[model samples]
Target: MPNNPPIIDVIIPANNEEQSIGHVVREIPGIVRSIVVVNNNSTDTTAEVARQAGAEVVDEPIKGYGRACLRGIAYLLNKETPPGILVFLDGDYSDYPGELEKVVAPIIHQNVDLVIGSRELGIKEPGAMTFPQVFGNWLSTRLMFVFYGVKYSDLGPFRAIKWEKLQILNMVDQNFGWTIEMQIKAAKHGLQYREIPVNYKKRIGTSKVSGTVKGTFMAGYKIILTIFKYL
Candidate 1:
């Protein structure tokens, strides 16, 4: 470990996740100094419940995964004391929030700059991932390798990165391509990256992306477009 422990922050982008955001906020490890849950135009009680569960809630009236994430990032940028390491995860309670310790270990102890929590490399509960999600990850990562020359398993949203390196990524995607855009930018900037196994289970509610036909199609299309856009 470093002479002083790293200050950690977590960002969760949620929309109408009133049923699950609280658990995601509460289960995160104590090493985290802040949990910023971005309510992405939620139609329900997500912000209210996230605040009740000890998280700092911010509102992003614009509805997009990347928009919510960027909102949280902007909030952190204005923090009097910024984080040493920043983690991004979903608010659907699909991932085991307690596993954040394992997610950031490489950054904490091994000087790694980025770590992706790969469900493919980890235990994923049955039905946790839809067919399109699995296919999209495979295709997107394959394209990344073919084009960007970086080999990665999945475009996982559950990832940890050094705060400084994250700033260098200059993430700009505002919708479905957010995760892929981050990974691509990280590779372009030559950040040291790793993939660690993480447990995944059924989320508390329907997935906005993989749960709907339009969502799945749009997500897949955007991911492919994002890969080529940066190429």
Candidate 2:
């Protein structure tokens, strides 16, 4: 491990998560150098709440998860001194923000390039993940193993990566394929990666991607399509 702690910055992509964005921001560990919440075309006061809770909020008028994440990355890249590590977290309270240290531990101590928080190996509250969400993760990961020869337990959004390694991925997906796109590119680029368990709970609001039939189908379709696109 380095004598000094690596500079860590967090990025949270939020839609209409006004009810949980504040909590997510406030609960993040103090080790983080900055917390950026991307307001992804939300009608609610997500930006206001996140700012009130000490997060720097950026607006992404386009309604895409990857778009919001890209906006956050752009904000960090403009900084005079960029962080050493970048953590991608959900604005929903479903994830335990306090466990951020655990998620980033591999990168800090083990010199791993990327770390994914695997909810599959973690303790989850009942009904935390819907059936479609579970099935989609299973199928998508299985397909990735077959096609890309990479084994991933869960494509959980709570993840961390070295800033330099993240820049090498050249992420371009503007929608549901954001997380998988990163993972796939990481595998292709030969980045050292690991997965650690992270507890999960019921989210404060309905998931925009998994709460409706249309949303679930679209997400599943996009994820599968993305896995094949890289092949």
TM-scores for candidates 1 onward, in order: 0.98, 0.99
User: What overall lDDT, based on C-alpha atoms, would model 2 receive against the true structure?
Assistant: 0.95
lDDT, model 2, position 209 = 90
Task: Using lDDT, give the best candidate's number.
Answer: 2
Candidate 1: where are CA atoms >4 Å away?
A: none
Q: Residues 115-203, candidate 2, lDDT per residue (tens digit)? A: 99999999999999999989989998999899888899999999999999999999999999999999999999999999999999999
Candidate 1: residue 32 Cα off by (Å): 0.5
What lDDT score belongs to each candidate, Candidate 1 first? 0.94, 0.95
lDDT of 1 by residue, 1-231 (tens): 467999999999999999999999999988889999999999999999999999999999999999999999999999999999999999999999999999999999899999999999999999999999999999999999999898888888899999999999998899999999999998899999999999899999999999999999999999999999987
Q: Give the backbone clash total of model 1.
A: 0
Give candidate 2 regions above 4 Å deviation.
none
